[model samples]
Target: MRTAVVSPKGDSKFLLQMRRGGLVKVYDSCLMAGSLYKSLLVSERTTAEEVVQLVLHCYNSSDRGSKYSLYEVCPIKSYERALHSNELPLRIQQNWPSPEHFCLPPQTESGGHT
Candidate 1:
């Protein structure tokens, strides 16, 4: 499996070639069904974290014969930096709620009631 970065300008493209009929299909963004490009070209402004998540989603969803060529839209280095950096925005981290937030409330004298 291979990963490609979606350009910051959102100008990346994807090219897929069929194994059986020797047909080549081109895509601009994720407009086609079952296309990885769709995963990358998310609605709203694309973020590095979103890109990574989409790429992983696509990779996991693909069958054995799925293969594609990603046109570099965002540089791979930028994605790497975003991934490694500890300064991600709070909104992005909010996707994974903190474990503390799921903790049960303290038990009252009634055992279950507050």
Candidate 2:
């Protein structure tokens, strides 16, 4: 049996890769599905006191026993800033066409064909 090399320090980087590599829809779905519970702990909607209970419930219901739910890892303001600052490792704009010369074809031909 062989194992692939993956650095623990690159967990977030791997996740970003997964997102860009066509896994974004499902990953975002999980995030959105669990967002309501996360939103409840957002700065003003609820107090810090309720965070733990809400997180525990969210963990049980959706996190599949993993402690990766955002609440436990995100109560601190600095962590939030760090999370927001996570830059995309890959640059994509270089592959797209510029809009300056953009054009569209006619909707129909003289023969009334699409």
Candidate 3:
């Protein structure tokens, strides 16, 4: 049987971007207690950088039985690119339809909805 596993670190980069954009915050009362996972779970203010740091800390501190690594969980290079560039990613642009393609058909004298 194939069991689905849910990960808390899935969107860590996106969250960091959101925090950098001023759309979220990285620290909170809960985070001061030193529970990284709990801080991430409860606060929408955590940044991507903070998440990356937490993941790294967890991965480095874990024993041999750990299932994943920081490199496997986070896209470090992509995040770095995003931090340096202002332009949207090519994938996002491709998904967005061109405005020219949405032009309305030339209207006739009869403007009835056929």
lDDT of 1 by residue, 1-113 (tens): 23554445567676543222111111222323444222122332333343334444654745221222222112323321123222222224334344222211111123231
> Residue 59: error of model 2 in Å?
1.6
lDDT of 3 by residue, 1-22 (tens): 2334454766643222222221
Worst 10 residues of 2 by lDDT: 19-28
Candidates' C-alpha lDDT = 0.29, 0.25, 0.27
The lDDT, on a scale of 0 to 1, for candidate 1 is 0.29
Ranking by TM-score: 1, 3, 2
* Clash pairs detected, candidate 1: 6-74, 7-73, 7-74, 30-37, 30-38
Which structure is stronger by lDDT: 1 or 2?
1
Task: Rank all candidate structures by their lDDT, best first, as comma-separated numbers.
Answer: 1, 3, 2
**Total colliding residue pairs, candidate 1:** 5
Off by over 4 Å in 2: 1-45, 61-114
Ten-residue stretch with the least lDDT total in model 3:
65-74
Q: Write the per-residue lDDT of candidate 2 for residues 1-114, one digit (tens) a residue.
A: 233455576554322222222100001123334332232213222322233334446456443322222111222232221111122201211222442222111111121201
TM-score of 2: 0.18
